[model samples]
Target chain A: MKQRERLIEALLALSAGISVLTTGGIIVMLAVEAAHFFRQVPLGTFLTDTQWTPLFADKHFGILPLVSGTLLTTGVAIAVALPLGLIIAIYLNEYATVGFRNVIKPLLEVLAAVPTVVYGFFALTVVTPFLQRLIPGMAGFNALSAGSVMGIMILPLVSSLSEDALTAVPRSLREASYALGATRLQTAMRVVVPAASSGITVSVILAISRAVGETMIVAIAAGQEPRLTANPLVPVETITTYIVQVSSGDVAYGTLEYDTIFAAGITLFVLTLVLNNVGYWFRQKFREQYE
Target chain B: MSNMTRNRLLDGAFRAVGLLATLLGLLLLAVFLLDILRTGLSRLSWQFLSALPSRFPERAGIYTALLGTVWIMVLTALIAVPVGLAAGVYLEEYGRKSRWSALLEINITNLAGVPSVIYGLLGLNIFVRFLRMGSSVLAASCTLALLILPILIVATREAIRAVPKTLREASFALGATRWQTIWYQVLPASMGAFLRELFWPCRGRWAKRPRCSCWGCWPTCRLRQKAPWTSFRRCPFKYSTGFRAPSRHSESTPPPLLLCCCSLRLG
Candidate 1:
């Protein structure tokens, strides 16, 4: 019995070690490649240059355009998702009758479960065409439609997480507000929402990280032009889309073009790491304070 | 405006807006499904399933991608399940709380949110490039196994944590050893719940992808473009959430299930 116990413990510890090892591997892989890329292009030029014409004969490797492109899509996504998601979450938690709530719950799951690629396909083939007719000078492959669909895609993330947060607020607080003659909307908006503020902020930030990392929608719909403009109607390329483009075609090992992607990957990895960890921090803070 | 009449009007307006907010999401989903079904259903015949992929969409099939997905899923499950279980049991039951254990806990949580495409990049570097697996089924399987491990570990830990502590003490009183108690009592009790939890995120990985990324969606799509919506059915966890939640609620927290069952039934 003693021998058997030791073996089981060893196996469990071994798997736990593997998890740690994988995390180390991710950091090391991205770091080493990115370091090599920076050797080819100076950090100053990469960060400060305005033009991102890497594939052209006059190759200027400015990362600003890509950064701007990413911000454009994510900016539009946050604009759409932040309001819609918060409102829906409020409606789901504070307003709906049980029967109405039940119907909406599965609909939320259905909306959430639709594949990102399916969203990409729909955005590219259906929505883009429709938008072109409605909005003048809206490029067939533009950031606006892609970002709009991505907003819809991450709607559940924001709404569901916010709902979870709102739901976590103790009933006593709501009762206390009601006893003070507060209306339901007033109680939810002023009392419960303020109480769940940290959690709601975390959800919104996590949604931002998700948008930053999203690839397929931007890859399929957003045109491959690495442009500096923030205009929604024009075509733009994002960091993830650039990675997809590079990986799809062979940039032979150890080349400058190959190195650029790892550099971009590092940037994306860092940005999302900061955002996601901040969200995780807020969640931890909220739980520690409340639970 | 009279306070009573104005209050009633505002309440009615709020209800209408809430219902509309809910309906808009449903309308978009309805259109997406309708479009996919209309475009892809005629191509989902047995011939499409059985025939090899071809250059022309008319003559194309999903056999290769289907087989690839099945093969990868089995391999990933085989690799991930045992490792996840062992890590969960160790972390939850055995590992004492310390700085090290706390770091591991936080790492696992963060790993759960790392993008799937990043995992694909890691797979490209580690399995296909360094290991020289050459983008084969085995490399993809390993990539997916790593991708899903954190999710499974989290689920297993949650399930084990959900199991009542009193049950373990009873087993100890009955003179059962730790291994025997876990194997005989805990495993039997939590296995159904654990399996359901473990399966959902694995399905989520493939849910967003029909043609697995390690395999590349473009090559297969170029070979056969017809079966766009074929992936919808294979992912069971989406709809199964509604069915699975209420049952598990009763098992874990019988008292709360009375209150939780209604909300759990839909989502």
Candidate 2:
């Protein structure tokens, strides 16, 4: 029995170490590859170059275009998602009857489960055309459609998470508001929403990070022209899409083009990592304060 | 307008906006599903399920992708379940709230947020290049196992946490060892919820990338050789358009959950 217990403990410890191992591997691999790339291209040039024509004859390695694309798409996505998601959460939590909440909640789950690639297809075939018809300047394949679909893709993430946050507010708070004769809307918007703001902020930040890291939707629908512009109506290439593009090509390992893939991945990783850490900090703060 | 009337009107308008937001999300989903079904449901005959992918769109099928998905899900489960459950068990039961464990907790949570494509990238580096596994089924499965690890570990911890403390106390009082107590008592009690949490998120991932073949490398190989018009027509359609059943399945789960919660509350 003693021997068996020791063996089990060893196995459990090894299992726990695997995640730590994976993170270590990613950091080391990305660092080595980034170091190799920076040896060829200066870090200043990579960051400040306005043109992102890496594969072109001139081979300008400016990442401004990629960053712009990611930002534009993320900005568009958040604009659509945050308000809609917050309202959906408020509706489910405060106004809806139990029956209504049950139905709407599952619908949101299904909405959340719908694949990004499908949204890619929807943007490509359905949303883009519909938008072009409605707005004269809308490109057939533009960031607007992709961003809109991504918004829909992330809608449930924001709503469900924000709803969880809202639900965690003490019931006594709601009862107190009611005893003071506040309307349901007043209680939800002023009392409950303020109480859940930290969680809501975390959700929004997480969603923004997810949007920045999104690939397939942008790859398939958002046009691949790397342009250093902030316009959502135009084609743009994001860091993620750039990675996907390079990976699909036969860029030999260890080549400058190949190393750029790692550089792009590193940037995307760092961007999301910052957002995630901030979101994680807020989540921890909220959990501790509430509990 | 009178003060009370104006206040009531504002409340009604906000309520309308909330209801509209809920309906908008549902409406978009309904349209997405209807669009997929209209285009792809008719293509789901037995021949579509049985035939190999062909050059012609009319003849191509999802036979490879379907089998590949099954292979991935099964293989990923084989690798992920034991490790994830053990990690969760160790963290919750054996491990204490030390600095190391706290660091581990943050690492796991951060890993959970890393993009799936980054996992794809890492899989390419480690499993394919360093380990020389290539982009075969094993490599992709390993990547997916790593991808699902955070979810599985977190879920297992939550499930184990939910198991009443009294159950473990009873087993210990009976002179059962810790391993024996977990295996016989806590494990059995939490299996259903744990499985749901583990598999549901993985299913969500699969739903996210239904088009990815046994390993992602295979599909990329096929695409690199040619324009891949047939793949554009088939793989995405098969994976994304084929989710109607699961949506219906998700719909069935909540009603019963509501029923149980109501019963418990009443009792």
Candidate 3:
């Protein structure tokens, strides 16, 4: 009996350890491949160079264009998601009836659950045309439409997280605000919002991280032109998009060109890791205060 | 009285904006569904369902793609569920408050946040190249299994944690081993919550198409070469480029594109 118990424990522990192995694998694979890439192209050029055209004969290996593209789209997505998500969260937590909140919350989550490829198609076919009419100079494949659709894709994530935060705020705080003759909006905006600020901040940061990592929508809608421009009206290629562009083609394995994806992948991995850790730190601090 | 009226108006205005904000998600969903239905509803005939994808847009159907998706789904579930469940059980039932366990917990959370495309990179490197799986369905399924493992582990932990402490204690007093206690008492008790939590990962894996593309599981490639007859080794690909193709073949592509949307809704 003791031996069987020990055997089962070992098996279960091995299964649990797979997650650790996965992380190690990601780190090692990216590092090894990226080391190969850096040996070919200097790290300074990878960092400081403005252009990111490796496939072309000119062969610039700068990562700035991809980084800028990522920043711009992520900025646009956050701009759209932060306010809208907060508003929706405020409405659901403070104003809506329980039944309405219950129904609408799940429906909103369906927005997130929809395949991003579908959103990419929507951005390309539906949104770009609409934006073109509204903004005459808008390119067929521009950051604005893709970023907007991605914002909508990420909205549920923000709203749901923010809503949980709002719900966590003590009831006494709201009642106290009401006793001070505060209106519903004033109570929601001032009392609950302030109290839940940390959670909301965590959500926004996490959403930004998600937006930064978003691939399909940007790949399909935002043209694969790696220009160092912040203009939402023009085409740009994000890091993920660049990775996709390389991977989908028949690039021979172990080549410097193929190694660029890993280099790019590590850059992406680091960026999101920082953001996630920040969010984690914020949540830990917030939990200490509340719990 | 005038100040009160002004505040009331501001409150009402904010309320209106908030309501509109809430409705925005529903509004977009409505538009997407309506557009897909309007364009693709007519093309849902049996021929469209059964025919192989052809160069001629009129003859293209989602038969191979659908079969591929089902294959991927089953395989991914087969791999992910057991491992995820075991991991969750270990964390909740067996893990003591040690530094190692804490590190493990944080690692899982971080893994969950790593982008799906990065997982694609990992899949391409480890599964496709290292293991020589050659972009087959097994490689894609293994990749997705890893992708969704964190989510499943978290869900399983939550479900197992929700199982009352008393149940475990009772099982222990009855002279059951820890494994038996977990398997018979805790797992059965937590089954409902566990199943509910399982739905999201299932839906997510079903909807996950981009990773397939990353694995080089293009539908055209899969269709040209007959996949191995064995269930485990089949080449399943999601038709991600179908949306892009319609731009050139506008006349014949909308139906299949719309069909994908409809099927997505059903899934």
Candidate 4:
């Protein structure tokens, strides 16, 4: 009996260790390939140069254009997601009846479950045309439509996380505010929201990280022009989009052009890692205060 | 009295704005579904379900793609469910507060935040290149299994944690081993939550297209056609190929609509 128990424990421990292995695999795989890439391209050129045409003969390898494109779309996405998500979260947590909340919460989850590919198609086929009608000179593939649709995609992330934070704010705080003659609006805005502010900030940062790393939506709808422009009306290429584009093609392994993706992958990995750690830290601090 | 009226008016206005914001999400979903239904309903026939890819848009069918999707789903479930459940069982039932387990906990949380695209890169390097899986369905399934592991593990841990301690104590009193107690008492008690948790990863693997596409899962359809279970490489969202031709909207629109309906039902 003791021997069997030891065997089972060993098996279960190995299963749990696979997660650690996966993290190690990601770091090592990215680091080794990115090392090969950095050998040829100077770190300065990779960060500072304004162009990113590695596929071309001239071989300029600046990552700024892609960074700008990523920032531009992320800026648009956060703009659309932040206010709308917060408002919806506020409505659901503070105002809605229990029955209404029950119905709406699952529906919001369904929205999140819908594939990013479908959203990419929607951004391409539906949103771009709608925007073109509204604003002349909107390119067929522009950042505005892609970013807006992406905002809607990540909206659930924001709303749900913020709602969880708001729900975690103790009910006694609200009663105290009411006891002090504060209106419902004043209590929700001043008391609950302030109390949940760190949690909300974590959600927004995590949502931004998601937006930065989103692939198909930007790849399909945001055009593949690696230009250093912030105008949403024009086309731009992001880091994930560039990776997808390269992977789809028949780029030979071990080539500098192929290695560019790993270089780009490391950049994306570092960025999302920093955002996630920050969010995790904030959540830890917030939980300590409450629990 | 005026101050009270002003406060009431502002509260009412905020309520109105909040309601509108909440409704906007539902509205977007409705519009998207309506558009898909209007375009795809007529083309969704038995013929569309049974046919294979053809150069002619009118003759193109989603049979091969559907087969590939089934293969991916079955294989991913086979690989991910067991490992994830085991990890969950260990963490909830057996893990002590050691530094190693603490590190395991933190690693899983951070892995949850790593982007899906990065997972694609990992698969490209590890499975496709190093292991020489040749971008087969097995490779794609393995990548997706890894991709969904963090989510499944977290869900399993929550479900297992929710199992009442009294049941375990009862089993222990009966002279059961730790594994037996978990298998018979805790797992059965938490089975409902476990099944519900299974739904998310299953739907997630179904909806995920880009990562598989990055692994070159599509091109193999044209190259290798031997076994649907082993080397099949058609992505369900290859409907995007049909979408390229605006006039063939009927051929392409139904598959994704069908995919959406099936996934929603699964959810």
Q: Which 10-residue span in candidate 2 chain B carries the lowest summed lDDT?
A: B217-226
- Mark the regions of model 3 whose C-alpha exceeds 4 Å error after superposition: B200-238, B247-267
DockQ of all predictions against the true structure, Cα-based: 0.19, 0.29, 0.43, 0.45
Model 4 is docked with a DockQ of 0.45
**Candidate 1 chain A worst ten-residue window by lDDT:** A109-118
* Model 4 lDDT per residue over B1-267, tens place: 698899888889989999999899889988988877876787888888899877776898878877877787788789999999999889888896988889998898788777777888888788777887767677777877887787778778777877889999999999999999998899989988777665642222211111112211122111222343464544444654444567776567776577677667666
Superposed by TM-score, candidate 4 places the C-alpha of residue B130 at a distance from the truth, in angstroms, of 1.3
Q: Please provide, for model 2 over A110-149, each residue's C-alpha lDDT reduced to its tens digit, 9 standing for 90 to 100.
A: 6555445556667877899899988898776688999999
* Candidate closest to the true structure, highest TM-score: 4
For lDDT, the strongest prediction is 4
| Two-way lDDT contest, 2 vs 3, winner | 3
What fraction of native interface contacts does model 4 preserve? 0.56
Cα misplacement distance, residue B137 of candidate 1 (Å): 1.0
Model 2 residue pairs with clashes: none
> Which ranking of candidates, highest lDDT first?
4, 3, 2, 1
Decreasing DockQ order of the candidates: 4, 3, 2, 1
lDDT of 2 at B97: 88
Across A1-291, the per-residue lDDT of candidate 4 in tens digits comes to 899999999999999999999999999999999999999999999999999999999999999998899999999999989999999999899899989987887687666666666777788889999999999988998899999998987787788778877888999999999999888899999999999998789889888988998887888789888999989999999998888778766788899999999999899899989988888887777652655
lDDT by residue (B20-102, candidate 1, tens digit) is: 87777677767766766555554456776665545454565545555655665577778888898888888888786977788
Q: A1-291, model 3: which lDDT tens digit per residue?
A: 999999999999999999999999999999999999999999999999998989889899999999999998899888888899999999999889999998887777766666676677778888999999999988998999999999988888788888877988988889999999999999998899999998888888888888888888888899899989979999999998888878877788889898999899999999999998988888788752645
